[model samples]
Target: MEISDSKKRIEELIEQLNKFAYEYYALDNPSISDKEYDKLYDELTILEKETGYILSYSPTQRVGDGILSQFSKYIHKGRLWSLDKAQSFEEIIEWHNRNVKAVMQYNKENADKLPPLEYVITKKFDGLTLNCTYDNDGIMIKAATRGTGEIGEDITAQAKTIKALPLKVDHKGLFEIHGEAIMTKEAFDAYNEKAEVKLKNLRNGAAGALRNLNLKETAKRNLSAFFYDVGYNEGDPFESYIDMMKFIREKNFPIDDYMKIARDTEDIKNEIEYINSIRADLNYDIDGIVIVINDMRTRAVLGYTIKFPKWAIAYKFEAEETTTELLDVEWNVGRSGRVSPTALLEPVDLGGVTVKRATLNNMDDIKRKNVKIGNRVFVRRSNDVIPEIMGVAEELENAREIIAPSNCPSCGSELMLVGAHYFCENTLSCKPQMVKSIVHFGSREAMNIEGFSEKTAEQLYEKVDLKTLSDLYKLKKEELLNLEKFGDKKAQNLLDAIEKSKECELASFIYALGIPNVGKKTAKDLCKNLKSLEGIKKATYEDLLAIEDIGEIVAKCIIEFFSDEKILRSIDELLAVGVSPSYEETLVNDQSSFMDKTVVVTGTLKNFSRTEIKDKLEALGAKVSGTVSKKTDYVIAGEAAGSKYDKAISLGIKILSEEEFLAMI
Candidate 1:
C-alpha cells in the first residue's frame, strides 16, 4: 500500500478500535468478538509500521515496548484536595449538621439564599488516584499520580494502557480529569495466575502497574478507571456538581454508573448501607462512600479546611486492611487435602474484629510475597470474613525464612507438591480434610442444613466415624445422640435439616461439590445456562467458556473437576441417596411494559428499596442501566433525580414517576 493510503487506513482503524474499546470497557457492551477486535488491531499495527507514522491517540501506542529510565515529575493544573473522613455514622451526621448550619448562616448573611442542602454520593474507590490532562485539541497530553496534591509523577505512557480512559475527546479545550485507576478482580486473578511476583491486593496491583518503569508490564495489568471530577477546565465553568459529572459523561470518559443526589442524612445513610451490602459483589474494591455538596455556590460558601475541603467528606468503612507482625506460620489441610499456609499474626483489630490469624494462600504465594516470620506484614480481611496476609510490610533483621511443611499437618501422610500447593492424598483419614468437607457441604450457601456447624461436623467425624458427604444422609438420630452436645431436640433437628437439604437447588448443590475457582455466582451462572447437573458435568471447555464471566481458568477448573473419577463417584453416591438437585427458571412478566426494554432508575423511591426495584425491573424483563443515554428506552425517576434524569430529559427519552412505573406494570 502507498504511504498516503496506509496513513488513512491507520486513522480509520484507530477510530474503529477506540470506538469498540469505549463500547466494551466504558459502556459495558461489546459490538464485536475479541477475535474480530484483535484482527483490526493487528491491521492497525501493520499499517502504522508500513507508513512509519503513529498517531498519539492510536491504539498501537497504548502499550509501548520500551522501558523508561526514570519517572519525570509533573505539576498538576489544579490542586487535588483530599477529603475529610468520617469513621462512624455519628461522625457523618455531625458533618451533615455542620453543612446545614453553614448553609443557614450563609442565607442569613447574604441576600442570595443557597438551595436546600444536597449532596452527590459516590463510591470511595480503593485504588491509585490519577490526574490526566487533555490539551486544546482534546488529545491527552499527560497523566500523573496524585503526589502531594500539587506535584505528581508523570505516567502518561503507563496511563494510556487503560483502555477505558479515552486518548482523545470531542471537546475543544484544555482540561484535567481526576479518576481512580483500578485493577478489577478478574484482571487481578488473571495476572496473579501467571505472575512470578504476585500482587498482594487490588490496590497494590494497580499502584505497582502504573508506577512500573516498564510500559509492557504496566499494560499487562489491564488497569481500568472511573472518572469523577474535572479538576481543571479551560472551557465554561460548571454551575453544579451534577453538571460537571454530565460534562464528564458527555466527553465519553469512563464514569462509574452509580451517582445519586442525597437530600438528607437518611438518604446518605441508606446509600452507604446499600453500597456496603453489594461491596463484596463488585468487580473492584471501594473503601468507603464520598458525599460532596452538589451546589457549586454552596460549596464556595462552605469553603475549605487546611487539609481538606469542608464541602466533601468520605464516610469511611471499617478498615479491611492493616499491618501486623508475622509471629509464625501454621500449615493446615483443607477439604481438598491441599496443605496451605496460615500466618499467625500479632493480634490486631481489623474491620472491628480481632484478627490473630490470616491465610497465606500457598507456598508459592509465600515465596512471591517474600513474607517471613518477624516481619511486619500487610493483612486484609477478605470478604469481611477470612483474614488474609497480603504481603510483607516491613522486613526486619530478625526475620526468619518461612519454610513449607514436608508432611501434612492433620495426618502423618507425606505432602505431594502440586502446581502452587502441597496436598495429602490420604483424604479419608485426615481429620481436618473430612471435617472441613462435611462442614462445607452443610454450609448455608451449599446444602444449607440448619444447626450444622464446624463443631457438629467434627463431633460427627470423630465420634460417629462419618466418612463421607453421603454418610450424612445415613445419620440416625440415635447415632447423633451419642455425639457431644447432641440432645433429642438437636439430633432430631439435625436429621430434619439434612432430610430437607436432599431436595436442594442445583446451583447450591454444585457449590457444595467444591469446584476450584467456582463461587456461588459462578455456580448460579452454570445452573442458569447449563440447566442440569448432568449437563454441567458433561460441559466441555468450549461450552463453559461460552457462558458470560466463565474465563479460561474457571472453564479449565470445571473440566478438570468433573474429569476426576473420585469426584464423580462421590457425586454419584450423593445422587443415589435421594439428593435430588432441581432448577426452575424464573418466570418473568412478559406482558409488562418494561419487557425487553433498557430502563434506568434514578433517585429515591418511596415504595421500593434499591434491591427490590431492581428485582422488580428484572422480573418485568427490563435491562436496568446505571447511566441514561440515547439508547435508554425509559427512565424511572424518583424524588431529587440528578444527572441521569437530566440527561434523560435532554435526550427526549421517556420519563416515568413511581406511580407511572407501578401503573405501567
Candidate 2:
C-alpha cells in the first residue's frame, strides 16, 4: 500500500482498537473477539511503521519497552485534600451534626442563605490515589500519585498501561482528574497464579504496579481505575458534584456505578451499611464509603481543614480477616484493672497496617476460640482498634494451649476471675492501671489537657504518687519540676493545662471518668439526655435505658459506676477541687410547620440550596427523609423532580413548591 493509504488506515485502526479496548476495560462489555482486536492492532502497527505516522494515543504506546531510571516530580494543578474519617454510626452522626450546624450558622448570619446539606456517597476504593492531567487537546499528559497532595512522582507511562483509562478524549480542556488505581480480584489472582513472587493484597498489587520502574512489569498487573473528581478544570466550572460527575462520564472516564446522594445522617448510615454488606462480593476492594458535600458552593463555604476537607468524610468499614501465626501471648492490665491476653503474631499486613499483636479478649475467649501458640489465627481489625483474634484458622501439630496467668502482669498481684474477665484487685499499687487511667482522663477527646503524654502520666504515677483522678487537679509546679525533663516552662505549662481541664463539658467529664462500656459517643448521649452530672448520678435503670444508643449492658455499667463509694467519693473530691461540668442544650422551635414531621426534599429549588432546605427543615424540628414513603408528611418538590416527586403524588402525600415551603415556614 502507498504511504498516504497506510497513514489513513493507521488512523482508522487506532480509533477502532481504542474503542474495542474501552468497551472491554472501561465498560466491561467487549463487542468484538480478542483475535479480531489483535488482527487490527497488528495491522495498525505495521501501517504506522510503514508510514512513520504514529499518534500519541495509539495502543502500541500503552507500555514502553525501556525501564525508567527514576521518577520525576510533578506539581499538581490543584491540591488533593484527604477526607476526615469516621468508623461508626455515631461518628457519622457527629460529623453530620457539625455540617448541619455550620450550614445553619452560615444561613442565619448571611443575607444569601446557604443551601441544605446534600452528600455524595461513593466507594472509598482501597488503592492508590492517582491524579491524571489532560492538556487542552484532551490527551493525557501526566499521571502522578497523591504525594503530599501538592507534588507527586510521575507515573504517566505506568498509568497508560491501564486499558480502562482513556489515553485521549474528545474535548479541548486542560484539567486534572482524581481517581483510584485498583487491582480487581481477577487481575490479582491471575497475576499471582503465574508469578514467582505473589501479591499480598489487591491494594499492594495496584500500588506496586504503578510504582514499578519497569513498564512491562507494571502492565503485567493489569490495573483498573475509577475517576471520581475533576480536581482542576479550566474549560467550564461545575455548579455541583453531580455536574462534575456527569462531565467525567461524558468524557468517557470509567466511574463506579455506586454513587448516591445522601440528604441526612440516616441516608448516610443506610448507604454505609449497604456498602459494608456488598464489599465482600465486589470484584474490587473498597475500605469504606466516602461522603462528600454535593454542592460546590457548600464545599467552598465548608473549605478544607489543615489535613482534610471539612466537607468530606470517609466512613471506614472493618478491615478484612487475615490469618497470622500466633507466636506468643502477653497479658496486660488496662485502666479498669482488667487483665487481657494480647497475642503476639507473626507480622502480617491487614488493611495497610502491620499488625504484630491481636487482642485475645480473655482466658474464656482464648479457650472458646481454641487459639494456641503456633497456630495460625484469623485476625480482624476494625478502624484504629487493635486487631482481634477471631478464631484459629489452622491448627499446628506442635500447638500448645494458651494458659491464663494467675498473677497480674504489672504488679504481680493475685488475679481474680470475674465472669469472662480477669481483674487485678491491687488497683492501688498496679502501675499500668494507674498510668493508663491518668492518660485516659487527659485524652484529647476527654479533658483535653494539653501536653499530656504517656511519659508524663507514668512520671506522675511514680514520682508524685498520683493515686486518684482528682489528684491530677492538685498537681503543682514544684511537684512537676522534680520530674526528669521538666524545666520551669514545661512545669508551668503542665500546671496551666491541668488548671484549664477543671472547666470541661459534661460529656468530656463523663468520658474521663472511665466508666466500663461507656465511650465518647455514649458519654455525649448520656450528657445530652441527662443534662447534668447530678441527673446522671440519680438516673434509674429505666431512665438510663430510655436514652438512644444506651443498651442494658451500658445502663448497668453506668449504674454500677455511680454506685461505687470510691467513685462517688472521687466525684465529690473533683467537685470540691472546683471541677465544673457544663451542658449546652440543643434548642428547636416546636411551633414551626414542619416540627416533628418527616419531610422529603427533591430536585432543584430556585430560592434555597439542597442543604439549605434540609437545614431549614431540621431547624424547624423536621426529620428530613431521603425517600418518599407513606411515612412522609410532606414532599418539597422543585424543578425536575423525579421518582420521589412521582411517588409522593401517587401516595397522596402533601406536596409543596419552593414558594409554598417558604410561605409555610
Candidate 3:
C-alpha cells in the first residue's frame, strides 16, 4: 500500500476500533463479536507494522508498548479538598444548618428574598479519585491521581483504558474533571476468574489498577469512572453546581444517575436512608453520600475550612460490624495438620448474618488485636469469606490472655509452632486432620466431588471405618444409604461424584494429596517441574528445590510426602480403583536465547499478561524468579517496576523492554 493510503487506512481503523470499543465498554452494546474485533485489530496491527504509521488515537496505541520508568508529577489547576464527615443524622443536620445560616446571611446582605436552600447528594464512590484535564481542542491531554490534592502522578495512558472516560469532550477548553475510578462488582468477578493475583475487594482492585503503570494491566481491570464535578474550568463558570453537572453530562461524560436534589434536611436524611437501604444491591461499592450546596454562589458564601469544604459534608455509613465478647479460643486442625485458632464469640447479629465464631488468624494476630477471653471484639465480614475478629472493642480488667495449646486438639500429638501457626505432627491419625483432608480432596477446586461436606466425612469415618483417602472410592450405594440424610438418590449422586472425581487433572490430584505447604499454585508448579506422579516420586530434594518459589521447607515436605509408605499405599490403591489423572505436555523451544536464562519480570507489560508472560518464559526454558537477585540474568521491567527495578539497577543486571524481550524470544 502507498504511504497516503496507509495513513488513511490507519485513521479509518482507529475510528472504527474506537467506535466499537466505546459501544461495547461505554454503552454496553457490542455491535460485533470479540472474534470479529480481533480480526480487525490484527489487520490494523499488520498495517501499522508494514507502514510504521501507528496513529496516536489508534486502539493499538492506547497501551504504551513500554513500561514507564517512574510516574511523572502533574500540578492541578485547582486544589481538590476532602469533605468533612458526618457520622450521624444530627451531624448531617448541623452541616445543613450551617449552610442555611451562611445562605441567610448572604441574603440579608443583598436584601433579597430567601429562596429554599437546595443540596445535591451523590454517592461517595469507594474508589480512587482521578483528575482529568482537557485541552483547548476538547481532547483529553492529561490524567492524574489524587496524590496530595495539589499534585498527582500523570496517568494519561492508563486513564485512557477506562472506556467510560471520554478522551475527547464536547465543551472542554482547558477544564479539569474530577471523578471516581471504580471497579464494578461484575468486572471485579470477571477479572478475578483468571487473575493470578486475586484482589481482596473492589476498592483495592480499582485503586491498584489505576496506580499500576502497565496500561494493559489497567485495561484488563475493566475500570469505569463517574464524573461528579469540575474542579476548574478555564472559561465561564456555572452559576450552580447542578448546572455544572448538566454541562458535564452534555459533554458525554459518565454522570451517576442516582444523583438527587435535597430541598430540606428531611429530604437529605431520606436520601441517605434510601442509599443505605439499596447499597448492597449496587454494582459498585460506595462508602458514603456527599451532600453539597446546589448553588455555586451559595457555596462561595459558605466558603471552605482548612482541609474540607464548609458547604459540603460526607455522610459515612457505618461498616457492617458489631462488638462481641470473646468467650474462648478453639484450636482446630486442618488437612495440613496446621492447628489454627477460632474465636468463640458471644452471638451477635451482624448485617443479618449470625456470627458465633470468627477466624483469629493466628496467635500473633490475637496478641496484636489484644483479644482475650471476656474481652469484647469487633467482627467484620467481607464478601463471602468467613468473618474475622478485627480488634478488641472493649477490654476487661480480669480478662485472661489466650494461651497456645500444648497438644493437638484432635490427636494427642505434641504441638509445634511453625512460623505464626501451631501444627500437629500426626497428619494421618488425627480425626479432624483426616476429615478435613477428605473434604478438601472432594472440594470444587480439587477433585470436584459434588455434595461432599465435613459432616459427610465425619459420618463416613465413624460408621464406614474410612481410615484412608482411597476408602472414599470403595463406598457402595447400599453402604451410603445406611448413613443419615442418605436417601437412594443422594447415595447414587455421591457414588457418581466419586466416579467423576477419579478422572481429575494430575495437578488437582496432587493438590488433593494434602501435602504440607502445597497449595494449588505449588501443586501446578510441581507438575510443571516433575511431569507426572512417577517423576514426583523419583525427584530428589535438590530437584524439588530447583523449582521457582520452592524453598528448603517445601522441598523437604515434598520429599517426605512422596516417601511416606502410607501415602504411597493410598496412591497405589487409588490407581487400582481406575483413578486416572492427566497432565498436559508443554512444548519447549530449546534454541531460544531465553533458554536456561534466569529471568525476573516486574510490574505490568502491554504485550503479555502476568501469567501469559511467565508461561511463555517457562515454555522457552527460562527460570522466573519472584524477586531480584545477583544471579538474575535479565530483569524484564515493565511500567511501575518500583523496588525490583531499583534492586536490578543496584545488582547491575540487564533490563529488557517488552519489545526487546519479544525480539530475543
Q: What are the TM-scores, per candidate, against the unseen true structure?
A: 0.77, 0.52, 0.53
Query: How far out, in Å, is residue 610 in model 3?
Result: 43
| Candidate numbers, best lDDT first, in rank order | 1, 2, 3
Identify the superior model by lDDT, candidate 1 or candidate 2: 1
Q: For candidate 1, what is the TM-score?
A: 0.77
Cα lDDT, all candidates:
0.90, 0.88, 0.84
Output the number of the lDDT-best candidate.
1
lDDT for predicted candidate 3 compared with the true structure: 0.84
Worst 10 residues of 1 by lDDT: 642-651
**How would you encode candidate 1's per-residue C-alpha lDDT over 1-665 as one tens digit per residue?**
77888888888898899999899888766899999999999998887777788999998778757899999999999999999999889999999999989999989999999999999999999999999999999999999999999999999999999989899888888999999999999999999899887888999999999999998899999999999999999999899999999999988898887888999999999899877766776789999999999999999888899999999999889888999999998888888888888889899998779999988888777888898999999998757678988888899999999998888887889999989989998978999999998998999889999999999988988889999899999999899889888899989999999999999999999999889889987998899899999999999999999999999999999999999998899999999999999999877899988899999998899999886797689878988888677679999999977657766876689999999998887
Q: lDDT by residue for model 3 over 385-428, one digit each (tens)? A: 68888677788998998999999988789999989989998876
What's the C-alpha lDDT at position 597 in model 2? 97
Tens digit of lDDT per residue, candidate 2, span 563-621? Answer: 99988999999999999999987677899988889999987999888756765787799
For model 2, the stretches where C-alpha displacement exceeds 4 angstroms are 321-325, 328-665
